[model samples]
Target: AQSVTQLDSHVSVSEGTPVLLRCNYSSSYSPSLFWYVQHPNKGLQLLLKYTSAATLVKGINGFEAEFKKSETSFHLTKPSAHMSDAAEYFCVVSDPRASGSARQLTFGSGTQLTVLP
Candidate 1:
């Protein structure tokens, strides 16, 4: 079974400082990974995704993630943190080739990011 683990349940950063959200994954096959952000009372937004292409993938709002096969890690990072960035983040794994119920996505518990001004 494919699974994702978010290292931190809560992360606090000062405004304009660098932000890092750590994630680790385990899968039986080469997996597709994604980072998603959710604002207060808002739906999840896709930050970035990796599908066996590039190791470093860029996403919306200056967020980026690097897929490291050796470490089984796909951690998200941003050069600076903004107040607007305070939200819930999720690490997700999907098996694109699977069918039926097996194709469902596996999501991490979630990481809440707090941007302190």
Candidate 2:
């Protein structure tokens, strides 16, 4: 079984301030973790993924996250916020053991980020 929880339903920030979105996960297997960003009326884009290789992962749009096994958390962080960053973010988890024909992605409800002008 694989599941993810997003700590925040919404986040608001100024145009130049930092951005942070929290996520937690639990999986029966090692688990593949991912952070996806979705612009308004657009499909989700892969930001980064953790395949049990590295704990620290860097993603596009100046976003990054650290995988903490002890804490079971993968939190997204950005040094600065931009107006273009305003969108919905989803935390996803997948299990390779469950990746054959029955493969499916478990997504967090999502976090709506609002970048202030």
Candidate 3:
């Protein structure tokens, strides 16, 4: 079985400070990890993906994450938070090799991020 845990249900940060949101996962096979950001009433956008090919992955809007096998964690980080960055984030896990179309993705509950002035 595969599962993802978002450590925080909400995170608040100043406009210019660093941003950090934690996530951990457990998977039976080599899993494909992804981070997606969703603005209010908007669709989800792919931030990054770790496909067991690279440990350090970079994504859109200056976001990045490292895949840690020992810790079973893939934490999102950004050097400086922007007002536009305020949105809901999600950590997802899926076996790319699973039977079914590649479009099938399992999403985490979510973590709401607030960027304060």
RMSD each, Å: 1.2, 1.0, 1.3
**Ten contiguous residues minimizing lDDT sum, candidate 2:** 95-104
Q: What is the lDDT of candidate 3?
A: 0.93
Residue-by-residue lDDT tens digits, candidate 1, 40-109:
9999999999999999999999999999999999999999999999999999999867876677789999
Q: What is the C-alpha lDDT of each candidate?
A: 0.95, 0.94, 0.93
Question: By the lDDT metric, which is better: model 2 or model 3?
Answer: 2
How well is each residue in 1-117 modelled by candidate 3, as lDDT tens digits? 789999999999999999999999988777899999999999999999999888999999999999999899999999999999999999999987887765367778899999999
The alpha-carbon deviation from the true structure for residue 101 of candidate 3, after best TM-score superposition, in angstroms, is 3.3
- Residue runs of model 1 more than 4 Å from their true location after superposition: 99-102
Candidate 3 total steric clashes: 0
State the displacement of the C-alpha of residue 61, model 1, in Å, after optimal TM-score superposition.
0.1
| Per-residue accuracy of model 2 over 1-117 as CA lDDT, tens digit each | 789999999999999999999999999778889999999889999999998888999999899999998899999999999999999999999987774888788999999999999
Clashing pairs in 2: none
Using all chains and alpha carbons, the TM-scores for the candidates as numbered come to 0.96, 0.95, 0.94
Order of the predicted models by TM-score, top scorer first: 1, 2, 3
Candidate 3 has a TM-score of 0.94
Candidates 1 and 3 compared: the better one by TM-score is: 1
